[model samples]
Target chain A: MSEKTLTYEQINDELLGMLERPHPSYFLLLLGFLLALGLFVLSLAIQIDVGIGYSGISHPIGWGVYITNFVFWIGIGHAGTLISAVFYLTRAPWRTAIYRGAEAMTVFAVMTAGLFPLLHTGRPWLAYWLIPYPNQRMLWVNFKSPLVWDVFAVSTYLTVSVLFFMIGLIPDIAIMRDDAILKGKKLKALIFTPLSFFWRGTNHQWLHYMRAYLIYAAIATPLVFSVHSIVSWDFAMATLPGWHTTIFAPYFVAGAIFSGLAMVMTVLIPMRVVFGLEKYITDHVVQSVCRVILFTSIIVGYAYFSEFFIGWYSGDVFERSIFYFRPFGAMKEWTLLGDQSIGFPQVAFFLMVFCNVIAPIPLWRWKIRNNIMAVWIICGLINVGMWFERFNIVGSSLQRDFLPSAWGSYWPTIIEFGITVGSFGFFFTLFTLFSKSLPAMAIMEMKESAHPPMRKETHG
Target chain B: MGKFSGVWASFEYLDETTEAIEKIRKQGKQPQVLSPCPRHEIDHALGEPQTRLPFISLIFGGLGCLTGYSFPAWTASDWVLPVSGKPIVAIPPFTIIGFELTILFTAIFTLAGMIGLIVIDTFRNPLPKGAKKYPRFQRDRFGVVVSCEPSQTKEFEELLKAHGAEEVHVENS
Candidate 1:
């Protein structure tokens, strides 16, 4: 697809115009999300005040919905890193249009994911004990535990992601600073000037800026892969049949990029529409992302197949039992037929297989992949599928263990469901605000690649 | 402000900007190139030396990786609190921490290098004592500031104007 030719002034006017006067729909969407955030906070307050038991975790199914949500949100954060760092390193041109929004999603998704472990701990206040700080109690966090590794992985991911996002923003902030001055927005100018570091775009500044950006991009690629891999270890290190697998690392990472790509679609599609950015965010870009989704989906599908094959081939009855029962076990009489079912909840398993494995198949068609509406619906389904994938992994294994006497079904209570819904609200709330205030697209990057006016051919 | 005076010339295109910088340099004056984003051609034209940020980031990241791995290993040895029948200092899992710290410090060092370069080069004055600002320079336009004694300002402005600058402004300190 040919690139849309836009001038520097036109790029600035269109992109920065969104920041200057956000559409009413932006506020309306933000308000709706804020309400969801309110519910999330209230639910979290209840969970803290009452107990972790409010989430409906019991007996053998101790690690229930919260952990599933934690893994899901963390997975959602991965695509951002891949797009911003990996794509930049690889020098994919389309990334310039969509990466800023993806980066924001990464930051907020990590923020949302961080909360779940704290909520799951049932003791949010003592969350600091996870840190390897020198306390007077003469106790250091277990350096050997994957959980401790998780704390470092996640915190470091947040720090690096935020810094990368901010470094990328400096030049844009300088443009915004100038716009603020031109418009006589004193307060905004005041905020942006210092943040811009008086960026005059000197050759010296560019030399350092380019080098720093490249290094951040290089560090971020491995950092992204390692973070999700470490998260997978949080379960892989455990002895449960479904959880104890060597494939979890690559599987989780692939699934993360898959779902993360879907999420990027989920965000950028509506964003492009509401902001009238079809010219910049073109169908060609959507098609490229769809192809990526198709690729990662196959990887995730392979991982799913490998896990079951390994389980059965290992000749371990316990592993075989979990694998067989997870999808085929009949629902017990006392249990509901829905996700809350005690006896081998098959719906989530099949839905996960359907959403994650089957849903992305349509993307193979060039026509459907380019169709924005079709891609959007498929991506939305993939998000649901990935979430259920986590649920099936966490719930199916934990529901029925080795001994029947130790077996138990798990379901989320009202508070648990509220928190889950609120988490979405939380993610979208920050993202909505970000889309309004910051340049959702990288203006400088667009300008860099923008076709300059025909240069005068000099004759020697 | 140390009797600093300069002519800020804004150009709508990179070619004109580079030409203006060259013309200023031919007059034996150093011109500060400014734009909305980095232009490699302009850097080449100005003959600006490459930055040392990559080297600094490599050093910091390598040290960070070493520190991340060794600190935990040393602590494990001193305390001897092994969990889950693993070794006192596990190499496999600790590698995750090492990897994370490496990236973290590389990013921190890279940012520090960028900001430090900016501060030393640009923000040395109490109140904009260095080069002048052309508003378009921060948006779509390219700018070059040829700072000299107050007497040289008119000559610099005329030189920049001759090289196809759209607008030329002067600042005196």
Candidate 2:
């Protein structure tokens, strides 16, 4: 653990330099992602052209890969608000270095998640019907359904997250504006000067700026908890045995924060490596993030336990079947994720438990927690685990429902898998571009935190 | 009329800038302090007024909540679409919309308030002629721009230099 202190000029020069001259690898990485993005778009087009029938979704398992991907992406989005808003409100200083990336992740994750519902809706053309508006049809959106609640929840989450991300950037942009003028980057100066809002660091402007920032943080805090809870209700509101559970809300919220924190590390580790931001990002920040991951992992572990315990204790047949079948039931015939006839996906269940619950156990040791490689590996595992968690939740539950006759298994078609991979490509593409454009680290806030003002007596 | 001349002095440290602002205030001249970052001490020393952003956000949030609840309630009642035999204006489910809207509106109001305040302040007292663009103030330096008559320029410059100014320049209007 090196405690390397950085100066304002050093920080400015190192971070802003990325924007000035990108590394060769940057273009190569982006080109690869662009290819993936093109492939993803192609898959989406094919799905649309061929219709929803191209998907593995069938009766009783209508929500397959699309819904799972939706939940997974939305879960990944959680850590952003948690890091930027919740940690700030709680007075955590370490968040200053890593929050910019996490916040950007949240925005992009939501953007990616926003697409799934439309994709899931076979008639993408009529997706606007989800919005409540007056038209010749006079048909209004149903406000009572949890699905309707989801439309409101996800959209509001996206809007607020974007605003928070941009608001946090104004001071940094002002810095860029000034730096541009000094460096004689005419084009950058022309673009950033106006966007800087002519900020002169006046007393009045600072006063309003600080107040507005605090209020935004205050409002965004609850949203960190609410948006995911509503997403959970999309399942909990249903009458299905595995879906309808009182524990679903908190359970889903905890899992969301858990997965989101892991994603932050996943994004930041490579980021720090490429950008050479180790001095600013530091081992201490990684340790802090890992500690949060450990805490959330414990909560998720508890939720997993409580869910099964309740299922067994309630003695409900349907609940018991879903629970028992999740971890134990091996099948001579089963549906693989890609719709292939397979032996059993019972492995996914145990893998989910191992990744989510057991993998984080190493983080309990300070030595392992501080080790970047170890943290990175564990965080990556958590990402995989959380995805499996969603898969098990959506797939296992639908695999064996109340009526054995209505029960069936689901495997994502090639299109589903391709679209899933493409979503990551989309996320990374936006993030890579974002890394170069704005101050990836909030320069102004970092400066404020690192070097606060020192008062001096008046000289008369 | 070019009657007033502005002397802008750059300080390497915040302490020097704060001291300069206080000295200028004692001399009955309001000096503007610019730095790369915002400081609470500077705001306190200048007696900056509190922002109305919190209040505005609250008002908008309340209105949004009301609209969130009323629009759904009204539409449900008007359309008479009872879901699962539950009341058209089901209070339990309506809270979700209300909660979401509250967050949405607060964010909207807060953003609007911030931009409005900055723009209004910028328009009311546009930056001093040459004071409009100083890049160093956003670097590791602080600036104090004093507005005074042309005759006071030499005095202000001497005052700043004596106190400790790395560089001093003047812009006359």
lDDT of 1: 0.84
Cα lDDT tens digits, model 2, A1-460, are 2322455676677777767778788899999999889878999999999999999999988888798889999999999999998999999888988889899999999999999999999989889999999989677888988999999999999999999998888878888988989989889888997887767776667778888888888888999898889999998988888889989888898999999999999989988888777877888899999888888899999989999999999999778767877877623243332333332347678888999999999999999987888899999999999998988888877777777667777778899999999988998899989988888888887777755434452441
* lDDT score at residue A438, model 2, on the 0-100 scale: 85
Q: Is the docking of candidate 2 incorrect, acceptable, medium or high quality?
A: medium
lDDT, residue A249, model 2:
87
Q: Which residue pairs overlap in candidate 2's backbone?
A: A337-A412, B2-B173
Candidate 1 per-residue C-alpha lDDT over A284-306 given as tens digits, one digit per residue, 9 for 90 to 100? 88988998899999999999899
What are the candidates' individual DockQ scores? 0.65, 0.65
Q: Model 2 compared with the native: what TM-score?
A: 0.94
> Candidate 2 residues B8-122, lDDT tens each?
8888867777777888888888777777778766766566657777888989999999989998998888779655777777898999999999999989988898889777765
